[model samples]
Target: MDRSRVTVVIVVLAAALALPFYAGPFWMGLATQIIIFGLLALSVDLLLGHTGLFSLCHASFFAVAAYTTAILQVRYGTPTVFAAPAGVLAGTLLALVFGIAVRTRGVYFILITIALGFIVWGVAYRWSSFTGGDNGVTNVPFPSIGPLAVTSHLQYYYLVLAIVMLCALGYRMLVSSPFGLGLRGIKASESRMRSLGYRTALHLYVAFVLSGALASLAGVLYVYYNRFVNPVTGSFQISVEVALMAIVGGSGTIIGPFIGSGVLLGLRNWVSSFFELHAAVMGVVFIATVLWAPDGLVGLARRLRKRRTGIRKDPA
Candidate 1:
């Protein structure tokens, strides 16, 4: 992380730690949801921003993980340790399998992925025996790792922070590795990468698996934290929110989602206090962002800095 980002994260964490004392249950709960969703949004950015692949079915893995965790705990009586990994594993396996087939060039892959996401959502909605149908699985237990159980809202918030940090760190390492370099290569020129025999499909499969796993982890955490998992968690709403956060925060960079999440979350919260027109506000914000600030907030900041310092233009 850069100096500015490091300082920002420090300040954010400090603020999070103090939230419980000042905020009421509603606000604290909202904060937890924002952080969890933010982590999932970061995963979306990992693929859409960095790899330049539009995988729209991200919520598929996320929902699958939630169902698996809910079933394990509510139906089969599995322990937290086992349930969490199972959720992640379910997501990874799906990503690996789907990524391979959907790694086609052009818009074909995007369509296929969108079709698959709906398929997953339909299953979650129809499968009443396992998923509890439209009601989703409720009373999903809080996980206990090494005898430390997260049973309350405050405890769950901290647990989410720890998990999000790990995901962020892991993503950072991956982006800094040779494989990440290959992704940037593909993003820059897929034909050139294919000429070099880079097996773009396989690389994408791996990226999808990692990305899906991260999203699923967030889903599982969301269910556990709230003790309720709904079908809407698998709905397009979740996917749209994640995509928006990534775009708004400045994708391809980990810090972007974190920053974007905070802004979006804070804005939503502040608006909910005064107006009943929250969705309209979000829609306007989203449209304005795409039209005027396509690079998102961080992108805008960088442009301003360059203009102010008058960074020398490249020699023609």
Candidate 2:
């Protein structure tokens, strides 16, 4: 990372750490969800935005991790430490399994993922005994990492923020590493990268698993925070929302999704509280974001930076 990126991360970490002391319960709860979704968006960014893979079926990977943790903790009496990793493992395996077939590396790849996603979703919603069908797994235990107790929503918010910040940093490092650079080269020209001796397929599989793992981590945190894990948590619509948050907020950058999730989630909560047509309002914002800011909130910030530096260029 360069100096500016370092500066940005430092500032963000500082702010996240400080939020609990300043923000009220309502905002704290909202911020917690925003952080979770932001991590999900960033995972989508890793495979889709950075690697140029158009994946829409990530909900399968997401739901599997979540439900796995729910089953382990709620039914089998697994500890939180085991539950988190078990969830991650479940998600990673799902990614690896589906990825082997769908790693075709383009639009076909997306279709394959969608097919897998539908299948998993069906199992989640239809398997009433294990998943509780629509009710899901309620009252998920609060996570206690070693000595730290993460029970309160506000306390849990900081824990999530810390995890998200750390994961984002790790993601940035992975993208900057040689393996990461190889993925970018593959995206630019897979044929050329293959000719250059890069194992493009293997790189994509690794990225896919990593993305799945990160999304699963977010799923575990989501369950812990809400004290609930429902089949709807892994629903297709929620998958769309995650994609929208990533695309609308900006992906592949550390802060863009956070900014996007923050604004969009805040608006959604506010709108849902008052109106029957909450989706209609959100749809308007989504359409506006796509039309006016295709590159996401981060893209808009980049434009502002360029303008401040006196560079003349058309946004469109």
Best by lDDT: 1
Off by over 4 Å in 1: 311-316
Query: lDDT values of the candidates?
Result: 0.82, 0.81
Summarize candidate 2's per-residue lDDT along 91-195 as a digit string, tens digits.
888888877853585678777777777888888889998789888887788887679667677778878877887897798899999998888897788899999
Clash pairs (backbone) in predicted model 2? none
| Candidate 1 pairs with clashing backbones | none
lDDT of 1: 0.82
Tally clashing residue pairs in candidate 1: 0
